[model samples]
Target chain A: MSTTIKVARPVDWTGIFFAVVLTLVIVVPLLVVGTWAFTNVWRFPSVIPQEFGLKFWYQTLARADVWSSITMSLTLATTVTLISAVICLPAAYAFARMDFPGRDILFFSFLAGHAFPKFGLLVAIAGIFLQLNLIGTFWGVVLIQLVGTLLFMIWIPVAAFQSVDRRMEEAARDVGASPFRVFWSITLPQAGPTIAAALLLSFVGTFYETEGAWLIGAPQVRTLPVLMISFINNQPVIQYGAVLSVLLWVPSFIALLFARRVVNSGSFAKGFGA
Target chain B: MSVLTIKDVTKLFPGGTKAVDSFSLEVADGELVCLLGPSGSGKSTLLRMVGGFETPSAGLIAIDGEDITRMPPEKRPTGMVFQSHALWTHMDVFKNLAFGLKLRRLPATEIKRKVEAVLELVGLGGYGSRRVTQLSGGQQQRVALARSLVLEPKILLLDEPFASLDQHLRERLREEVRDIQQRVGITTLFVTHGQDEALSMADRIVVMRDGGTEQIDRPDVVYRNPQTPFVAGFIGTMNLLEGTVANGIFTRASFSHPLAVADGPATLAIRPEALDVTPAEPGAAKVHRVTDYGTHGLLDLDLPDDTRLKAMVSHPAQYRHGMGVNLTPRAVSAYRNNAQIFRSEA
Candidate 1:
């Protein structure tokens, strides 16, 4: 008779440990904030809230200033995404396909938006906005937000366009489609998914952008992130800040859902030049 | 009537390298001409020039007697099939075929009819609704061919269309393409590096080397009467012997043959089948290797001065390695300064 020795599988302790740490890192903050948003009274030394209700939610939603800021943020994000797409997509295509003098240098210059300390750059741009009499205007907010969008709009779409197969375009041309028709029919559709992913990133990034809006549109335009900063600083109630913080996460959460679908479609990786 | 004429078309890339230099070709109506050469031999560049994907640095290109030298590819009445199928993955097979016709603003019914007919012709009749990515490699290639043929262009250019397929598929597809070209009666220009493909498919093979024409002849003529040493060496297996031809005789180290040529230094090229080998004692050449390929056998022989020669024989089992053999030239083509000087009849 042959004896069979049973082998015991080793537990992945390191993997489990890291998974627990990561889960706590992400979930604990949200859990604490959520608790604060609902709590009416959680005095010092109390491990848990003594009283919890919907009072903070009602108070945050009732403010006219919070309502205006929400509207302003949405409008700025939408406008900036649209304008950035219109201007930067064409530039991205050219950067990907065409050759010209100093093209490499010029394309890399879009990175200047995020390469420096953004607040310092925003202060410098605020000086120009002041001289141009553009300070405290919505267009000033739009222009500054546009700067935040350039890296996502240009770099990602450039990768998307570059990944498109050129032979497909030539095949279209051989079939009697003009250059413009080939681009419309062949090139754009092939690059569409990745470009869509880039647009999502640009819109979500613009929505959460704070420095440009605060520096340029102060006292006139207050986006949600800018409003949340003030709410945290001035508001005596901790629930108001917590409520605003949760509100700030709404667009990002929704964007993440859409982003998952886009990533699953496999174009998101190509947009990052994978 | 010639459907396409390329006269002295040359492509000098910006770096001053001439990819196609003073190349000229004329394709008869309904004829299939092949530009045959090794890579970098400018066969594809010439095809691209005709298809308008490339501009010739100098010279003229015409289709049906109209100059299309400066015409864009879309404006030119020419269709090209690339080596890669280049099918639009976003569209189904049906939409891919219909796209060109729709651009020409053909009626919807007519577009459907034409697309369906071409699909049938390419043996993909019921594959119209299938996504391009779902089909096999050979199916994608057929779709590519169907896409070009449905346009009914004045000239068709194929740049190594069967190059990506396996050997068996390549042979089958080349025969199918040749059949379709004949059935459609469309003038075609095929560029390929496979000599077997050129010999089997082309009505005329244009042998090219170093961006220039070496020989242009019928397949049989190109095989039998190669005009240049490059063509002789490239088209098939040939045993080249360095020798001198004088007084109606060719002579090398220990071998001599009767020839009629004005001779100085000359290279003699002979096909393996054209050399007759006989077993002999203490012969000038010794059998080095023998390979039996079922239908025919190949014998590799080494001369006294170590010049190796290959001969195709009907019976390879009779010759043993290290055995002595005498070689007799049944037919030979002599070349002088890269050009064929004389070819003796068997």
Candidate 2:
């Protein structure tokens, strides 16, 4: 009779304690916010909900304030993802496969944005958005996000495309494939997961963006985070104020699932080697 | 007329690296020519020019008398295989075999028939449906051949195709490639840094160095009567002696007796196998070391002036190191080309 032996992996209890405690720190507030949205009468000193009702949710849904903001944010994120994809594929291919002028300078310039704070661009970008007659419009918000967002999207796929063996492309050309066919059939499919990851991360970046929304989305375009702030600032300081926080997290959950599939595929893992 | 004419092709890189300077050769139709050289010898760059991956900076490359110097790679009637079999990873073996045919817009039925025929020919009879990633390394290489051969291009270019494989596989695949090229009667150009691969497969061999042709001849002609010293040294290991030749006798730098020589101040090159090692009947050198490499043993010996000469011998038990042995050069040919590498440089 054969028996199987289980091997034990050592655990770090102190590290685990901090990890669990920190996770609870983030999660406890989130759950409390969801609970607080329903409780009608509440006091911090009481430490327990006195009532529960769907009134806040009902009111928030009916006002058209939250819905319009959600729609606006989705529209803005979609625009940025689509536009960023256009700039990313060709730029990534050129950087990865072709030898062109300003290659290093161009690549580092894209990375330079991530080095500095995105908020630093708010004042200058707001002024430019205003000058371009882009304030309070979906395109206006898209224009501002495109600068910061595209740098990351390009970085991920550039590495992905480069990670595919260059000899493969040379072989394609040797087999009578034109440069375009080689890219379509050989290089692109190999880098599929990396492109997907880039898109998901780009989508997430646009979805949670508040500064661009708050700065340029004034007067007409009010995104989700902006509207959430407005509703929380409503008179009486109701305990239902925390419900707006739930709205902020919904799209992030969707993005997390999307990013999981892309990141786990082996194709994207090659991007690190490049 | 030559099937391909490379007229004085010179390749100078932008950074002033003379990769293939004024190099030229003619490959007749249906001839398997191996461009043989060591690494950085400009053999690969010369092959690329023929495949249309590279354009010569200053010469005309004509395929079957038609100048293709300016044509793009796709338009050229040539097929190339690499050191690594560059199979399309996304496509199945059948799809990969059919891709070039599909690009030419052949009908789907015709594509299927053609792909099946090629798969059978390459010994992948039941592998048309498998993805390239699923196949073994050797299988992937076979698919790469099927992919290129299906197009039936006028010329086939292989750049060290078996260099990526182990020795056993390399030997088997080289034979397979030779057999296939012969069956198709396609003009093929094989490039390699290995002398054995070139010797075994090529109908004719073009030895290149420093961006120019060193020698172009049948394998035997190049071996027996190497026109230049570099060809003799690079093609196979040869014992070179610095000597001055006068009337078929060479006066070596180390020895007093006048040895075999060319007409003037000459370099002496002798193959190891050409030097016979045996019990002395007349004149011989003493064996310094007997290296037995299973199949044969190489006897390292010193001549009159302490200059060493190596001979491939058999039977490790026949002789011991430090024993006095005789040398009789069974074959000696005096070649007097200006490209003869200096004895010192060798």
Two-chain complex of model 1, DockQ on C-alpha atoms against the true structure: 0.82
Expressed as tens digits, the lDDT of each residue in B1-346 for candidate 1 is 3489999989999999999989888899999999999999999889988988899999999999999999999998899999998999999999999999999999999999999999999999999999999998888999999999999998989999998999999999999999999999999999999999999999999999989999999999999998888999999999889999889888877778887888688999989999999889888699999999999999999988889899999988999999998889889999999988888767
User: Judged by DockQ, which candidate is best?
Assistant: 1
Weakest 10 consecutive residues, lDDT, candidate 2 chain B? Answer: B337-346
Assess candidate 2 and give its TM-score to the true structure. 0.87
Worst 10 residues of 2 chain A by lDDT: A265-274
Model 1, A1-274: lDDT tens digits are 9999989989999999999999999999999998999998899899899999989899899999999999999899899999999999888888889999998788778878889998888899999999998899999999988988888788877877787888899999988898878878998899887787778888889889888888899989999899999988997888998998888788788778767866786655655556
lDDT minimum window of 10 residues, candidate 1 chain B: B254-263
Candidate 2 stretches with Cα past 4 Å from truth are A1-63, A111-117, A235-274, B244-265, B279-284, B293-295, B302-307, B334-346
Error of 1 at B106 (Å): 1.5
Please give the distance, in angstroms, between residue A68's alpha carbon in candidate 2 and its true position after superposition.
3.1
Q: What is the lDDT of candidate 2?
A: 0.79
For model 2, how does the per-residue alpha-carbon lDDT over A24-83 read when each residue is reduced to its tens digit?
999888878888888777766787777787777777678776788778888888889999
lDDT of candidate 2 over B1-91, digit per residue (tens): 2397889898898999999988778889999999998888898998888888888899999998999987888888888887788887888
Instruction: Say which candidate scores most in lDDT.
Output: 1
